[model samples]
Target: MRIIVYGSLRREQGNSHWMTNGQWLGDHVIDGYELYSLGHYPGVIKGMGKVYCEVYRIDATMLAELDALRSKGGEYKRELTSTPYGSAWLYVYQHSMAGRKRIVSGDWLQRDKES
Candidate 1:
């Protein structure tokens, strides 16, 4: 299966170890989503914005592990979202983003450069 990751799960970021079994497809830009900062990581929700993400082909085991990690505390939900590569699973934010800072560029790495 394929997955789209826009935060720490991306290459060189924290939590990337979970993707050791995944095959990096390439980077992609997904529309209709907004990125927000959740301290050490970021989350994406359906919106009128665009988000930069990485696509990866992973096995069912890795997918299950990621599902658990992202769904913890009900912070995110896995949804099938469209991508250049194919329809991939995306972790959509599930909680209120009341005070969370929005990453305007929709790119987690660029968020630091914007600071």
Candidate 2:
């Protein structure tokens, strides 16, 4: 299965170690979505903007591990979304975005540099 990673799961980020087994498919920009700052990481939700992400192809074992790390039903909800490369599962924020700062640039790494 393919997975789209936008925040800490991206290359060189804190949680990227978990994705080491997957094959890097390259970077992609997914539109019709918004990214918000959640301090150490970023959250994505359906909206009217773009999101920068990296695509990866992983096996069911890796998927299970990722789902566990993401806490599927709590912090984030996995959703099937279309990416430039193809269709893939991406995590969307589960709770509220009321007080979170929106990442206007849609690029988490760029947003981090601004801080």
Candidate 3:
């Protein structure tokens, strides 16, 4: 599956490294979906804040592992996101970002060329 990461998990050495597949679909600068209320909802926040990540097509096992990684963040839930490249598995803001401004394309924040 093609995964769309919005946070530090995009880092080459982030804790979610276990979910990284053989190749990255592309480098994307997506928005940060902040979780609120002890990880229950998205709450209030604009979808403008940027985050960088390498998109990849992983397997079911990887998807499950990613779901586990998401548990670390309090209020994130899986949702479908349409990206420039294609459809992706995006972690929704849930009730945390209830009234935030929406963004079409998120930002990629990885500055390291190696990443």
Alpha carbon lDDT at 98, candidate 2: 98
Per-model tally of clashing residue pairs:
0, 0, 20
TM-score of each: 0.96, 0.93, 0.57
For model 1, the stretches where C-alpha displacement exceeds 4 angstroms are none
What would the per-residue lDDT of candidate 1 be over residues 32-62, giving only the tens digit for each residue?
Answer: 9999999999999889899999999999999
TM-score winner between 1 and 2, please give it.
Answer: 1
Q: Candidate 2: lDDT of 53?
A: 95
Best candidate (score: TM-score): 1
lDDT of each: 0.92, 0.92, 0.53
TM-score of 1: 0.96
Cα miss at 107, model 2 (Å)?
A: 0.3
Q: Specify the poorest-scoring 10-residue window by lDDT in model 3.
A: 35-44
Considering TM-score, which of the candidate structures 2 and 3 is the better prediction for this target?
2
